[model samples]
Target chain A: MAGVAAEYFLEAIVIKPIRLRGKIKNGIAEVKALLPHPMETGARVDSEGALVPAHYIEEVVCQRNGEMVLRAEWGASVSKDPYFSFKLHNSTVGDKITISWTDNLGDTATGDITLA
Target chain B: MHRRALVKGLATLLSLGLLPLNLYARAVAAFTAEQAADVYRELFGSAAILPSDRIHIKAPEIAENGAVVPITVSTDLANTQSISVVIDENPNPLSGTFYLTEDSAPEFSLRVKMGRSSTIRALVRTADGVYMSGRQVKVTIGGCGG
Candidate 1:
């Protein structure tokens, strides 16, 4: 068996808020976020005989124009790609929604979507 | 030559015996208590969580597959701030966490992945300073040897 460190490539990836239809009905603003992460559990080994360290996104926060709206804390139980959906109150068509997250490895990702 | 053949046969049996042992070892490596506590602290800041009836967590008693589990958390508290779901025996205890604002209602739902049979806990923090929690859900494997 290979070492864990050499088993896989670790990259920090972020998604800029992509607008999706059906998120808003009437006045409530619904937002969905998809973050790219490997969520490694630090248990697996690579072909290079290295032990892969556990790396996963630990915190997620969603804000509407500097106002804290939603927040989440996750662990390795989350899947490879983490997706979150939330609803914002009294949001109009021009409000900005910001979603940010920090991984266990200190990697951070942020995405923003404009309410329409 | 006969002695050598006997030794080889014994070696083969020993190897076969080791195979099942290895499989069992992997199965038991799914989750640990220390890992669960780590996840709990990361989410709640401490393991001394007080269980409250204000939060109601809905989940299937026995999950057919360990891969996908559907969980719903609802609270009667006004101005609920956040809701979190945790699996006590999963490799990673923290499953899903949701932060709710005054604009949103007090109920939220989501799907989480489970690596094996474990206890799921939901914690709810209201707009006030008090913290409340719900009960544990027992998840079981259906067909997937989870």
Candidate 2:
């Protein structure tokens, strides 16, 4: 378990923290991340029957050893508490993997992991 | 015509001394688009996706809860540039698109919401061309309404 447990956030603090886990095997590094978000679609009404405003992750970027590996653009249809995973090739034991996401509300969370 | 109008509007603002630095950021047209093909065309610059067996989508045949249908997409296509997921019947059919580099593997997993039983598609944009594969998912309960 090479999970360094790195979580970073700026002002406009989000409610929950982001999680990242990673490991390298057979020249490949596998990474999994959980970004806690409401993921509101702007269509659902509250218990009071008022439409909930849309708030979801707009983009996510991943880096390997300070090099850009992946960048993703998302819409509101992604499920709540979004779970994402991806892999990297030609990986080494000490490779650092960084994941960050920005939401529609302009909130962001970044975390990193050192693969073992 | 639209570009000309936008230029004219900018000129009018400039003439009125109302020009501001970076007035408005270019909006991502595909992010809010409702149609799947249009979204694809807007984002990847192509909607004529050809069917391919290389793209593999792993998902449930029947999703008990439409709010969270888990899926994983992977492909062996060489020079893979990007992979994206599309739900045919969602209000906004495009769920997400992952742009990858040479260091990144051609595998992506994410959860998505479905308004109803719909076709889930995995599209691959490679150096050669755009390819796609899809699977049908039946939702017992709708989740997008919420």
Candidate 3:
């Protein structure tokens, strides 16, 4: 069973900035992101009848032009595909913003937004 | 008359047992070290969290609901880069992760869901390294069930 575990990989991950009012305003950017994770409750059992160990993304970071403006750490309380929204100070149209996260298994995912 | 007395005696014993059971349940909901390490690695890319007073985490000491809790993270470091919030005993471990750019404010606020009573950690990383702070919050439900 442990051998099979190595073959399992993340199914899919999605990241999108939550647009405030569905529009960009005054160089201030608001974005929300969601990542798809099983978030194994650590209280559930898998198909083989083994208790699935808790697995979840613990950290996320958003970067603009190589400078980080926001970072977060999470625990089991967060729902699966955890969703979050935050603000940036002077995001102009066409600027590149990157969001990245790492899970408990050392797996990492990333997404980007181009201000419109 | 004997039957009624026996029933009363049993009731008293049951209530006494229940008192300790309730306390035990609350203690179990508290955060553990394993959960804390897991959350730290998820947020900082490693378990290299250095305690710092620069980062500020705002959350109620006691939350009425374990489902939806309000939390806020702010920092006072220069060239501030990122801020993140984490609940130690949530079902998943990592609650929310935010990335910041030069144009980002040094502050952020959000509401998260928690499944149990646990410590909430706020982590901040600058271009150089990472810093963190935490607080324990008690969550109450119908019966203090995590």
Candidate 4:
């Protein structure tokens, strides 16, 4: 119950936001996703020269038609507000694609699109 | 009705293990050079990380926004298995690791958050267990705390 409350709050605040789009062409689907994040490396100093704590996306999962297409492990090296694109073959016009990301802080967000 | 079916389908997918549980788990907060080397060891086994010009890293010499720096890694190497990116100056050096299938092209593009000016390194592993890398990308931070 304790963990459940925090989980709900994290989802409610939406620290990770994603924008996803997909299109089908020649039996393949091209997907593009934009994710906004701080991706803090915990090395930078604040105005007072205090080191910021580490915060970055840890993993990104992409699913096509309910099947896992890609899983990415990301560290602090990825730039903030990351963008990604990939292709899926043998996909139809109406196949569903979902992209989800989890950060080091355990916050998560998801975006999905149906191929057109 | 459609929403119900989608929910059920997601449940099925979860049961089938189509989703990676690690995505929901917390990740390492920071990765030092030693830890980055360990990650390489775990992935490449005894494969030596050799420097090669085959892998190409395309990034701006100066990033307008440290929060979202665009990068591309492309290679002409055959039988490529995977590619990984590293940032030399970031608190955590290892940024991304991509596994490419035979059908997948040996190229990838993505945006990452950087803390400051840094060198971007792209490493590619071929199917023959040989590890090759591209040149460093000098990223000048225009934003962030830098």
Best prediction by TM-score: 2
Ranking by lDDT: 2, 4, 3, 1
TM-scores of the candidates in the order shown: 0.64, 0.83, 0.50, 0.72
CAPRI docking class of candidate 3:
incorrect
Q: What ordering of candidates by TM-score runs from best to worst?
A: 2, 4, 1, 3
Q: What does candidate 3's lDDT look like per residue over B56-136, in tens digits?
A: 888888888765577777888877665656666664455555555576677766666666678888877787788888888
Candidate 3 contains a number of clashing pairs equal to 39
Task: Tell me which of candidates 3 and 4 scores higher on TM-score.
Answer: 4
List of clashing residue pairs for candidate 1: A2-A47, A2-A48, A2-A49, A3-A48, A3-A49, A3-A50, A4-A50, A4-A51
Residue range A29-63, candidate 1, lDDT tens digits: 86766676666666645555577677777777777
| Poorest lDDT segment (10 consecutive residues) of candidate 2 chain B | B19-28
What does candidate 1's lDDT look like per residue over B19-94, in tens digits?
3412112111213224755645554564366667777777778776665566667778777766767676665466
lDDT of 1 at B66: 60
- Which scores higher on DockQ, 1 or 2? 2
List model 4 lDDT by residue over B10-109, tens digit each: 6678789996653333223334443556656655667788877777888888776777788888888887776788776555567787666554456668
Candidate 2 per-residue C-alpha lDDT over A20-89 given as tens digits, one digit per residue, 9 for 90 to 100: 9898889998899998988988787766556667778988889888988888888899999999999898
**Quick one: ranking by DockQ, best first?**
2, 4, 3, 1
Pairwise DockQ winner, candidates 1 and 4: 4
Give a tens-digit lDDT track for model 2, residues B1-146: 45346667876887787986233242378767889888778866844689999899999999999999999999998999888888989988999888899888999889999999999999898998889999999999998965
Chain B TM-score (each prediction, in order): 0.63, 0.78, 0.67, 0.68
lDDT of 4: 0.69
The interface root-mean-square deviation of each model, in the order shown, is 10.6, 6.0, 12.2, 5.5
